[model samples]
Target: MLIFFKERLALLSVPKTGSTAYFKSLRDRADIVVSGPPDLKHAPVRRFDRFFQNIFLKMYDTELEVMAVVREPLDWLGSWYRYRSRPELLGHEKATHDLSFDAFVQGYLRTPRPAFADVGSQSEFFRTRSNGRGATHVFRYDNQQAILDFLQDRLDTEINLTRENVSPKRPMDIAPQTERRFRKIHAAEFDLYDRAR
Candidate 1:
């Protein structure tokens, strides 16, 4: 997460949504950059509200408007699948080296997902709290220009981003039937991505 106190903005790092590049580009300008300890780095809306929000409210006397980026559902899963397939994860319990894309996605749809397909849901990540605290701005992963424009205008500085933590390129075709099931099971994810600008 990257916080700009002056701008009253907190950019939530939604996993696999090109947040690493944004972090790299904006770290110096951000007042608080949480880029370590994966759990903290990827803190979802509920987590942030429960842990960090009150601290900022009490100490900084500021209510930061959160921002997040969400990728298309299938693409997001594909990124996770490809990422886990990396050679470095070959021996890991979460490795996807032995699974096909279809199998991986199917596993993801399971009630108790197998380790290799346990990537968290984007919709869940940005879910609004009961008090209505959630991301005020949401961007689509495919729309880098919109993200850049918003950041530049909001931050009052030109922004340049270098790609970082990109997953390996691979053909990610899911079986049509399996995809139908996935879509049904993960409708919220698609809805969230569609709603994003």
Candidate 2:
């Protein structure tokens, strides 16, 4: 997560959404950057509301507008699948080296997901708190220019990004029936991505 205090903006690091690259690009300019201990680094909307919002309001008299990027549901899952397939994770319980994309996604749909498919839901991550606070600005992963434009204009500074933490390139094909089931069961993810600018 990157916090630009002066701009009253907090960028939530949604997993597999190129947030690492944004952290790399903006860390120097951000007043506070949480880039370690994955849990904190990937702090979601509710976590921010619970842990940091009050501090900002009391100390700085600022109500930070949260921003985040969300990727298409299937593409986001594919990234996770490919990432865990890396050779270094071959012996890890969470590795996807032995699973096909379809199997991985099917596992993800299980009530108690298998370790390899246990990635949390993006919709859940950005869900609004009881107070109706959640990400105020959202960008689609495919729309890099729009994200950049918004950041540059908001921060009043030049922004440059370099790809970081990219997952391996692989052809990820899910059976049509499985894809249908996934979309039906995880419709919230699609809805959230569609609403992103």
Candidate 3:
């Protein structure tokens, strides 16, 4: 679901945050079609880059609207850690190599990797070479319905959004201290989020 969002609505799948649910709804609605490259697992980045160049931007040139959703980084990191560290999601080999959340966060900062490394970032999906820079619209994951409404207007089509693939169990709550750390860790993102408020 981490496809670029341009002509075809790319759901920059930011790991958790109900992305599975959103993708399922889009699948059922058939508002648009979805496809991935044949060598998805081995060369995912190349797949995405090629898709953007060959498909997404090409579609945009023809006047198609593109869109996606993003979650707050703290929430995104929490879900990502759980997904990567939890026993069920990984095999013994991968599980044994797990890094602590704090360590992972540090590594993420040191490396030139994509934000979240699950879903593409605001910069990745939206930015254009000509300098419009990242997207016509970005919907906060917390306010998906508003985004859907905006999409409905842009697409000139009715979309009755619904959910699917929700986890039966609740996620561990984000603690006050963790929330504060997250705000500090992603100060720029926090500032932008606040300004948008």
Candidate 4:
């Protein structure tokens, strides 16, 4: 996460939506940077509200508006599948080396998801709190230029970002039935992504 004190904005690092590169590019320009420990780096809306918001409110006398990128739900899952398919993870139980995309989705559908398919949900990540804190701005993962443009205009500087932490290239296709099931199971995710600018 990168917090721009002057702008009163917090750029949330949503997993699989490619926030790492943004974090890297904005680190120096940000007032506060949180990039260590995967759990903290990928802090979701709830976590941010509990921790960062209170601190910012006390110190800055303003709540930083949160922003995040969300990818299409299926594409997001495919990234996770491809990521886990990397050679280094071949023997690991969390790897998707031996599973088809359909199987991965099936695992996600399970009450107790198999490790490989327990990719986090984007909708839940940016879900609004009862206290009215939530992502004030959201961009689609595919809409990279728009995100960069937003950052550039907000920070008053050109933003440069190289792709970082890309999932491996693969024939990542899902079965139609699996896609339908996934969409049904995670309808809110699709809804949220559709709402993203």
Candidate 5:
């Protein structure tokens, strides 16, 4: 997460949405840059609302507007599948090295997902709390220009983001039935991505 206190903006990191590159580009510009301890680095909307938002509001007499990038649900899952299939994760319980993309996605739809397919829902990660609080500016992971334009204007600086954490290339084809089920169970993810900038 990157916080620009003067701008009253908070950039929440939504996993697999190319946040790392943004962090790298904006770290020097941001007043507070969190890039350690995955949990904190990717702190969800609820956690931000509970832990940081209220405090910032109290101190500054205003709350920061949160920004985040959400990717298409299936593409997001495919990224996870490919990420875990890397050689280093071979034989690990949570690795997807031995599973096809279809099988991985099918397992992800389970109530208690198998360890290998336990990637969390992006929509859930960005969900608004009961107080109706959530990211104010959302950008689609596929639309880098929108995010870049918004940041450049808001921060008054040119941003040249470098690609970081690219998953290994692989053919990831989801079965028709599995894709249907994924869309059914995770429709909110699609809805959120569609609403992004």
Candidate 6:
């Protein structure tokens, strides 16, 4: 999808989703490289319309299979905390300053501020079909291997992926507080995410 817009293929990165490592290894393989060794703070995926158009349609639309990897909401939040909190890794002055796992979860609940794409829910992003080419696939981070195989078939490349964005923070099984916050903040996304779960 991003490739259609910039005329180059790029890995639409999402925060704390092991995308950093995934992109690092795949950077050279990708035709239009958005992920690089230098490490960009606000990469292209950080933009709102990451997948602006699909060249096939010659319209400003996202392409099908413009999928994203979604983690268990709570686990996702925990991993995000580890990534952003590490100022050195993320190269942010205060990436995690004054930010708590609970607070961030609350924020996501309040507004599922997707680092990439416009809407929240994974289904929303995928369901949103565009005459111009929109995302059609969504891979769960828990099932990355299958997603990678799918991508391999699509891109016609042998991808040997390694490295992950694992955080030391213990996973919180029941995020009641987080759930409550999301219920209020990301009402629609919460509904969708729950339904999917």
Best by lDDT: 2
Record all residue pairs in model 4 with backbone atoms less than 3 Å apart, i.e. clashing.
none
Residues 65-153 of candidate 6 have per-residue lDDT tens digits of: 34455555556556655555554645454354455666556555444353421123443433443332432444566777776786677
What does candidate 3's lDDT look like per residue over 88-131, in tens digits? 65554323124555544554454464333333333333335543
Residue 156 in candidate 2, Cα distance off native in Å: 1.2
Which lDDT tens digits does candidate 1 get at residues 1-197?
99898998989999999999989989999999898899999999888887778788889787888898999999999999999988899889999888889999999989898889988899899886797588889999999999999999999999888978878777787899999998998899999988999
Write candidate 5's Cα lDDT for 28-74 as tens digits. 99998888799899999999888889988788788899999989899
Report clashes for each candidate as comma-separated counts: 0, 0, 3, 0, 0, 10
As for TM-score, the candidate ahead, 5 or 6, is 5
Measured against the true structure, the TM-scores of the candidates, in listed sequence, are: 0.96, 0.97, 0.56, 0.96, 0.97, 0.59
| CA deviation > 4 Å runs, candidate 2 | none
Model 2: per-residue Cα lDDT over 1-197, one tens digit each: 99998899999999999998888989999999898798999998999988888798888777999999999999999999999988899899999988899999999999899899999999999987898578999999999999999999999999888978878777798999999999999999999999999
Better of 3 and 5 by lDDT: 5
Instruction: Enumerate residue pairs that collide in model 1.
Output: none
Pairs of residues clashing in candidate 6: 53-61, 62-133, 62-134, 63-133, 63-134, 64-136, 65-136, 109-182, 109-186, 110-185
Ranking by TM-score: 2, 5, 4, 1, 6, 3
Better of 2 and 5 by TM-score: 2
CA lDDT of 132 in candidate 2? 53
Off by over 4 Å in 4: none
Superposed model 6: Cα runs more than 4 Å off: 1-11, 36-65, 87-100, 107-133, 164-175, 190-197
Instruction: State which candidate, 2 or 5, has the greater lDDT.
Output: 2
lDDT of each: 0.90, 0.92, 0.48, 0.88, 0.90, 0.49
lDDT of 2: 0.92
Give candidate 1 misplaced runs (Cα > 4 Å).
none
Compared with the true structure, model 2 gives a TM-score of 0.97
